[model samples]
Target: FTNPDSTLLTKAGHHKLCHYIALTDAFPLPIDKEEVSWKCLVKGAHRNEEMINKLEALEANSTLKSRVIDYVWGAGSQLRGELIYKARVAVPSAYSLPGSVTEEELRKALNWLIQRMQLTHPDINAKVCWPVLYSFAQLTSLKACTCSEDKPWQHPIFPHLIKTQWWGRKGEAKKLGNKEDSNPFINTPITLMALVATAVRPFLVGLNIF
Candidate 1:
């Protein structure tokens, strides 16, 4: 690509050492045709592009994905996909709503993030547009909506809920996620032994209004 003027084959040599290991006796091919094509490319030089054409020319013999595919999707002890950094998000304080995001702000925030990250290379500056512009395009359209977010701490918002969400139980609120969380003698005095309804008890302890 650095070359000011070059032919298609000019950059071909660099791509020569690429290898495509889509098929082995033990491991079956994954679902992506592009991956298989690129995989074929790395296996050998001239053999690479042949796989690309082959991928386009023929229909894939579809098969169930293997365990290897599953593991990569989310292997042992590891979480999967984007928003691996899921955490409670607060709306920028400047906005009128104290704890929640409006529909438009939410849309714009998501749109900007998706575009900045370039989640899809082919489609840059992807827009999170509405079905009908006239629906919510008024000057007063940005009216803030409040969230009765009783459980703000566990909000696996957006993609987190849609694609990835998790649940956790707690015995004592004061106790951190450590050995003390479990041992009654050490933690009971600090914050009495919590009831079995762990989800509700902790939520009621320190909420704002009452």
Candidate 2:
């Protein structure tokens, strides 16, 4: 664990410290290395404003964009590709993910979709649009998605999920047969807003996607 206010590592350890910061900043922790195979590699991963800027500017076409966005969201939002994709299957939300979708697959899809959209609407803001679409896809499907016994929950896996009523429209809570509200339907718009608000703003500005 890093001391919040102090430097995690010395100047000589910049490269090493960068990785841990990257993990902490990009994903929710209490992460178990054994569960995922790439744990060790991430230990010394580089992270910085320059690196972040580079990543944000890499490309936002459907394919690469989707993968990058998925990685970013998956890390920070604490979602897994299989889980999110499965949710996509249950509803026609912000974006679509067929049963076969993977982080790699979605990356390709987003790259193609965003490129086509950009050609016709050059004024399109890829940064905001990319995540917005992803969120839309996730939220629409969230209303009807569920996890299996082996599935991991970003939050806690509970028996019941309390879906918030959209637009204060008096929506009903669907029962997943548990006492806890584990899979609640997140407010899509708010989720989207939060994502856009906290994204690396300078990077978006550089891409002229703000």
Candidate 3:
């Protein structure tokens, strides 16, 4: 098992620490070897290549950042894993899709996300919990995909959705578990700056689309 590079480990650690507490509580369960392996990695049992890749990708991906941030802010809000899975699949596939993602692809992604959550959060009651989780990912992805390279950043839709993506839902902030004294407001100065930067990022692509 390889320790991920610092940047990746840092992001993964933030996710594990901030968003996966309940999932962490139930791990290394009695299951087949592959499932056990998946569970181990999800629980940080042994950092292997796949784990490193996931961590690295998570760190580098701006799309994942907002969703992860939102998920963390809603900690212990009693969401079902199924819903989360739908949202996860929706984000990437939607970005890749020419149009909105199809129901079939969304379903497949939901299945994939279920497996991921099972490996990471075995205690999750999938059948009942998935819908709630799906809503989060769907909304986050919908908001994020508004500014893809194919779309002009200056488009009204891009700014509006990106703003929602940046600000997120103010009501969820209390669940983040940050030290109460330093809890961030929905309109934190830094967040506002970040929103501006993200909104303007599309203009920079004129220099290099890649």
Candidate 2: tens digits of C-alpha lDDT, residues 1-210 = 132211221221233222232323323343542223123223322455443343344344345434433333333333223223333332222223344545544444445433332211212222211222554375332222122323322211111111221112343223323334442233232342222223322222222321
lDDT of each: 0.27, 0.29, 0.35
Return the TM-score for candidate 1, rounded to 2 decimals.
0.19
Candidate 1: residue pairs that collide: 18-42, 19-42, 19-43, 20-39, 20-40, 20-42, 20-43
lDDT (Cα, tens digit) per residue for candidate 1, span 1-210: 232221222223222211111011112234553354333333323545753443333334222122212323221112211112232121122112223534654555444433332221221222233333566674433322223234322222322222222212421222334465463323323111111112222222222122
lDDT of 2 at 58: 35
The order of the candidates by lDDT, greatest first, is 3, 2, 1
Error of 2 at 66 (Å): 30
**Model 2: residues >4 Å from true position, as ranges?**
1-77, 80-83, 87-112, 117-187, 190-210
Worst 10 residues of 3 by lDDT: 119-128
Q: Which candidate tops TM-score?
A: 3
Q: In model 1, which runs have C-alpha deviations exceeding 4 angstroms? A: 1-77, 81-98, 118-210
